[model samples]
Target: METQLEDLRQQLDKQCLINQELQRQNKDLEQRLQEKEKLLQELQGQYHELDGPSQRPSNEPEFRKSRAAVISSEPIHETLDIAGTGVKKTVSETSLIVKAIQKNDFLSRLDDEQIAMMVDLLVAFDYSPKDEVIKEGVEGDSMYIVADGELSVTQAGRNLRTLNSGDVFGELAILYNCKRTATVKAMTNVRLWCMERQTYRTIITNKSKKKREQLMGFLKTSRTLKDLNDAQLSKIIDSMDEVKYQDKDVIVREGSEGNTFYIILKGEVLVTKNVNGHQKQIRRMGKGDHFGEQALIREVLRTATCTADGPVTCFSIDKEVFEETIPIEHLELFDDSKVLQETKAPEKSGPSSTLKFKDLLPVLYQEGRHQGDPVTLGVGGFGRVELMTTLVHGKYYAMKRVSKKHIVAKRQEEHMLFEKKILKSIQCDFIVRLHAAFKDTRYIYMVMEFCVGGEIWTKLKEVGRFDEPVAMFCTACVVEAYAYLHKKNIMYRDLKPENLMLDVRGYVKLVDFGFAKEMVRGEKTYSFVGTPEYMAPEIIKNQGHDFAVDFWSLGVLIFELLAGSPPFSSSEPQKIYAKILDGVFKYPPYLSEAAKSIISKLCRPRPGQRLGNTKNGIKDIRHHRWFSSMNWHKLRMCQLDAPTVRLIRKGPCYINFDRFPYDLAKAEEEFSGWDRNF
Candidate 1:
């Protein structure tokens, strides 16, 4: 009995040892499984990021593609009698009108004279209680300022807000053609001051034309401005403000700190200086004469006092404006020798070398080169971009492989060819460099310099919005690129974060010239192209558009960079178009006055009146107050410090880009013979 009990104890001990070993193995397996699940989740997140709509191609035909061919026409500028019959207003009424105009952002931008003229053109109107002053969806041709009583605003049966006295409504109608966005009904008997669109435009256009003509005439005969071109003079005019002084008013006091350059527009001024404890006349200046020219170059004490001889009118620009609009080097043209040297024609040079398809075909088709399979970088509706390295040269390049069948199906052959042509012809630091173009039976390929820092849109997604300085730097880069392209008569119709790439240095490089077209000055194109949110109102209307459209897109890009979204956006393209056409948008309270001003000027509904498209051209934009601190010279040379440099250096070169899966399906069909030129 003792021997059997001992055997049972030995068996129990052996069973306990086996159970302990099994528990240890099970815990080890669980840990490994948990690790695998974590890895799987991470990979799924990466896959979804790459598969998002952000990377999807946004290019689409305009919703009105089925409409009849659009006829190209010059922008209509209607001329009205500046001295037409006007309604006289009492002193109190005039003061009220001025206050009302000043309260509105759009009207407040107008000058004192313009505001006065607008007030004179306003006609008084009375509305009964509960009467509909403006109906939603009805075409509006006039704008109104509430003089008394209250009005209600509603859209789609929802009360948007209430308009009290001095409120402005339907103001966009006076600026452009658009249907009323919301209905305005009189809650109580309302008195309003209204101005028709034609009348408003006349006051704006005729006033501007007259002022420009007067300034140009004066600037042309001024000896101090002889070295400047018409465009330069125009820019100066834009920066200057009119100042009127009564007879004998002191325009500049002797020994006072001076920083304003003045040009005489009307009347005369007497220059006097205090010499030997008595005032002595130095000179008498008339129209076309200028004073305080040295004040524009540097800070100096006034050497003389200039008093108005009679009722004097002068155009005055501060030193900041003068220096920004006209560079110091350009001002050197004032020297006679420098002017002569600059006017002399330079020796003609040979044509610049461009990438040729024939020369690149040999390198691409070398036998036994041992080139590895290309890694997919990005995938889009048209095709994909792949990372490729040449074994012979050992250089990495981005090979854009566009499927031939896809282009044919979308009828985008012309656009594709044009893009290739543009890429080959341009050589700019801010633009992606295309080294070669070649073709296969299934695809057309463009080999370009690889931008390792990847797309700006990806960075924007990581950070909700950019700080002011970073946004300014990025915008300055685009401005440089646009300046070059616009000089070549090329319009980059597509301007968005997705189309802008950053290099290893974190400098922006504009890519994908699919929608770019070289239109001659004063010419317009009818074809619709561009991302929906960035599309200009003219493009949405199917009206003729030119380089001005690019400036409109630039405004959208600026807003998106600073606000994390475009001002006009919707999931439906039609809604976006409607918003753009309405020409109404609110600025966030955080936006600086300068930022809001530039965006407003750039996104003007009238293309001719746009900041960059005006007679002053891009100078108007470069000298804008928002870029007051920007060193344009440093920005153009890529010497400005980039905000993304530290972030980029810490990660892999291509960290900002998502890895896309390679398409394993065979080409649906082979395209032959048509790509002979490539």
Candidate 2:
């Protein structure tokens, strides 16, 4: 309810601001109308004062000659399709065109006689009811005025206003090579009059010195080319081509390689991305927005697909021109490979076994020596982890340093204590080993076993979605870890990809024990915690939950691995929880029935009926049909080959480890009793 209310408030504020802007424009238009009327009266008075009755009817031929002089030097063909608008007008429509032009603001500045002469250059168009007359995001070469019927103005899928007979639009397109600001749809079968770019320029250029001024004005407003030097801007101005688009055309495609960068000149377009299997609309790009420039720096695929909402237009610069014009500094983009810890042994090296906590402790703690200036590995609300090395043993480890202030404020002292104790006691090949805990004035720190492969979350995204075998390998390790923790009566209340890391050998290990709790037989805890996507129905419903919750999360993780989205995934938390309670989701056609069956049995909303929660316990999951062909013993001994692979090592900088160097190390505050048990 609070989220919905906040969203409504933001939308209301946005609409109110737009209404205020429209009010200002309406006032200015009114003031301009009054001034135009005054100017017309003054012109009439001057005509009478200068000519009087001496002006003769025979001078009509000379008057015609004066009108002809205002036309373009290079004559455009009459009775032609203007700028591919698909509608043509003949001299027969001159009077009607002139009358429509007289009602427009900027074009209305011309005298009736001048407007009549422009009839040769103007085009007439007919649109059926609901026809898109002008599309937003599309560059337009012509400006339109409603000769009859009405049109609706829309932007970003929202209707902002309406236009009736004599209302002018698309002028910005004709005035400059830019995207359409909004879509104009024919509300009724409409007759329209239009003036193309060349004709509009001739009208402005022949009358005054506004040609250079207008081009300069457009150059100033360009967002894509804003970073270019004056010389570069000048070159683009001369070489840029005029392109046009009609309604519902595709501008760019996601995942396809792109070489051109586009800046909208006119019209609105919808930006969408492939989220799971759906076309998720991300945003609407209108005037001034630049797209496809990221492709210019180096080879990369188009990140989002763009389609015309209606008719759209824009300026496109090729890679060659962009590279030359835009000065790109040589900066190395962060390689994701560096973010994971090295987990694989070198070629010819034998199989590596998981080291014991007792063996790694001495390597982590050096006598009379401290770790070097910390290079941050990662950070979150839980606190920060940094790269640390020993002086005597020359071994490396991950040191998780947490702020005491945050722990005290959130009243999580008990949770912290449980985490430290649980981590120290657990001994599983697939679980991260906690060597020792210490404290200073402002922080409590833990020295943990370093897994060269970074979080599985990072690896999962890189692969898009995992294949069944890879998913099986990763999940098997997690299942074994859960089996161990459950035997010790420690419930892993939180389970997700972010807390799982891969070692150099591509073996997975569970980390972070902040949410783990010890529970004896017939004991249940009502701790309302866990990630939204994987949180069990019982936790969300405030019902007491047990180790079954971890199994529920495992099902969600498996689904995410196979389909790239959780079965009950939703942007809204309430909707997600509702979906979870309903406990229903369609399996993709490509997903194996075996995988579906296991997830269904594990995620059963009623904990009593859920798998793993059965009397057989964790063995119910380990012995499931999905792992029927597996040798669980080999996986425990790190003998199973990973479908997606990496090998890594420990060093001053493990390239596989992520770089997030934030210095949380502050002067030690004196808090002796607060960290005595740490």
Candidate 3:
């Protein structure tokens, strides 16, 4: 009986252990089943979101850019309204502009007629993800009024800020005729309205002078020129006088005495100096540029020599003229006497006396109104001419764009800073306006006033050559712009067809300042520079010269305008140099005797013998028999009519097409690398 009882107890203990093990196993299985059910439900939700026509893109993000196209690839969907009806609206160029302007202050201020005219000029644009809207350092052609979505303003590899609807850029460059300070990139699908400089000038000129003054007042508040006023703006415009320069023409000689300033109306100029006994090129200048302001401010000798890189045009102004005409407050910015009294240099504080470009850019951009879309007219080494739009308190403006990389060489940085100085100091219609600026590590953007008619190069090429009277009239306009620049002590080095832009009314605009440099007093430069075709013999020989070189280029430009080809040329650069050294100029049979005579006087081999070599340099050129029909005083006031009327012209190149292949590739690679980082 005891053995049987012991066996039963053992069996009962084994059964109890088995029961506990089974219970634990069953609980684990139940938990796993619950987890499986949860996963299945989550997958079902994902399928519902992505399985149909409403599915979003697989690779594109929520805010990706799209091309400006007639047809869109987005998924289509039907919507049901409360009354079982649906209403839809399609996007159009006019609608896009309306949307963009409604968000901005300046464009919104325009009357219905003005707004309609602006809308008529707008073209539609769409952007893809990572598309660059504006390049840094180049003059801005257009201001973008975002219809929808977002953009980012970047500089030197840093994100400065993001811009949205109602935010306008490129106005600072347009208002000031300076280089762009930042790069703008589209962050999402963006629609923008583009306006050009020509349109804006036309609209303003059509208005009464009082209205124009009001407009000028609106532009003066920009931080870049925080101190300028309406009277000063008018004086700057009135003081403009155009002068021409040829390749290798000396603009300002080192150690020479001068009290004038210059703004580049056209072409390229090179700044060179002896560094450690070796002559080196420090910078190059292009159109809408300025130089030699130090001489204008004080009794100082020229510090550097400037020579034309090609046939160049400039607007010049003398210091005395400025003092007499410009408002006292406007003169105070560069007035040594006033600046010293208000805030002495070498001190970083006190009214922020020493101007740092970086600190001033934002204020300029913020104060100016948003202009119109950048008009597409032409492209050159300095980049594309884009139409832009601007706005102030819901009113509209027009602008142009200049690229930094296109003008400044890879090695030049300080040259760009100098260019900004020249552009910001003056305001005029003959001069391309500087509205706003932006930049990035790879490029710079200059927002400027847009001109609808395109450049003089295209016109000349289309028309072949101009008649004698027409040539004189055109030349007169160029000379006026140059007079303003030279009077300011600015040297425009390059003067070529590529740099002379024109508006609808055939008003010439000198643009590009990639090679511009500042000349302090008593400075001498000794650098070999200039394009082969238009180079002056003295510059080629490395002999020093001064502003008289501009007259030489003017002679060459006149010859070209009258005759199809430049006065001197050869098959090779070496041969061309030889011809230039020999001072060989030929007048075609078609050239008028008066025109030929003027060319001869302007192109004299000796700087002193050139038409504009004397203290009243331009006076001689103006008095030349070719200008016998012109009234100098009336011409100065733009009382004479333009020889030709310009029609809307399409840019020579397409924006969708790649102009800077290397840059585009680099930008792509950089963005891809960043994608990996993310």
Candidate 4:
């Protein structure tokens, strides 16, 4: 049996190597194919130019025949000329956009109505020859479609190809929220159509219902997610991220640790591996094929390297969610495996503490809201949460308005800017999505996904603590949310009930990025900015703290959820901070031993000696005896309901919040230069 197992292992290894070699060969073939296509296009253009003054196709319909079918919108007369000389021709601007959208596979998959809606969202532009449309390695959204012009695609100063009329670039970046892979410069003075990332996603979800269904279909067919029902699949699809990759881009490298699983939605990928120090191509993967299963399962090195054969589109899901979607039996098998946790061991606390907020942030500031009074959802000293509506689609959103005067006065601008950046990266379902952000002269506005069930603090206080089962469900969600945050190197400084809000479905959506800090492994901060009772000893003692601080706060949060108040609480702020430092909180006689044990371990006096701060970190907490009877898989899947989630009466249940008007305590005199980019 042993010999057979060894032989099987060797066979698997050999096949993996062969698969890699095949992928390499496939990639080479793909590159060659692209070169030949480029040459062919150049020859065709030369033939047309040299063959006499035979005019190019006059109608947008001529191009649409070979590409996608154009979808017309409601009666509107917006026209654009098909002429290359920048003269007004026959076609309408909407028709030109439809012509361009049809050329891209992802956009082409949308129905006619989606195409029409996309036409409305497009913002047209004109550029001169040699104008850099999109620069390589720069982070941006806004896909550009050439309306009438030629553009050169280059990487590392080498010309890769030329894009003519109806061609699109930056689609992948906009779709995935990733960095641009190549430079696109106008070879001829041209007209183009562009759309922002949010607009594009909105068009798909709000307008193109068919495309959303198609996305669900992709998830349904996935081998790992095949067993999930349609409802579960739909939920998963909402969290899926679309990423675009250019040709020769390494999707995953063999032996490197991975956290995300990829499913090819468009184009092809080459899967390769190394054998005896020689690179080998194994196999080629095309649309609908998924790779990196081991990655989504646990902390494991990729078995094969995958590269984009040409322009590729993929849907990705990180390990945190993947673990919940699949069967528990599957996860149990990998319990003994070695998972490499990425640790960015900085020499110090990392970035400079005193960096100016104005310098650190790229403020996407906007003006003119001369419409309606801000509908206040909740309020505090220096900031307020209000409901804002977009003029274009009329969709409502929760906008967090923070006072610039207060931030500058306290010298907390760096902390504030850092918080926004952390919110923008790598979002998942449990985390509140930062949809759009804007800054003005007086305040900064963060447009975020609105949760309907009010703060957990209100719910907990109304119910006067929770049963063990109810607290367990809420705590599990926090664990998953923090897992995503900690994986991204973000430490949530505050984890009290006030920051935990419930969605309409009762799942917790972690919010308030105000005190969150980016602390990679080996890096720490000594900032003393947290609710007094929830502050970890390290922070209170002026000792540098890291992700462990959040876990410590989690302990206090759990205790509060069960006991109706925090383990260490006092009317006086100093007394509360002192009790937190002493770490001598007691549990009531009615509290279960299991619950008390978790709080004790979590709220340990020594920050490094805390339950979750150990080598295993979150893993230890998940496997603890207190949660032994818990169905963590169900909890993560949101299959289990929070026994304590309040029944919301209104659309958002803002009634549960404090009804009195909030004061502008930070209404201190605004300073110059400081509040300009605020």
- Write down the TM-score for model 2: 0.45
Local distance difference test, candidate 4 = 0.66
Worst 10 residues of 3 by lDDT: 64-73
Q: Provide the lowest-lDDT 10-residue window in model 4.
A: 60-69
Q: How do all the candidates rank in terms of TM-score, highest first?
A: 1, 2, 4, 3
How high is the lDDT of residue 296 in model 2? 66
Poorest 10 consecutive residues of model 1 by lDDT?
A: 62-71
- Runs of candidate 2 with Cα error greater than 4 angstroms are 1-373, 647-653, 664-672
**Candidate 1: lDDT of 417?**
84
C-alpha lDDT values of all predictions: 0.74, 0.66, 0.55, 0.66
All candidates: TM-score: 0.50, 0.45, 0.42, 0.45
- Tell me the tens digit of each residue's lDDT in model 3 across 520-604: 3122233334445566655554333345556777787787767655766543344555667667565566567888788887786
Whole-model lDDT, candidate 1?
0.74
Cα RMSD, each candidate = 14.3, 35.5, 34.4, 29.5
Clashes (backbone N, CA, C under 3 Å), per candidate, total 0, 38, 184, 17
Badly placed stretches (over 4 Å) of model 3 are 1-376, 390-409, 520-523, 646-678
Better of 1 and 4 by TM-score: 1
Off by over 4 Å in 4: 1-374, 391-394, 644-646, 650-653, 662-678
Candidate 2: C-alpha RMSD to true structure equals 35.5
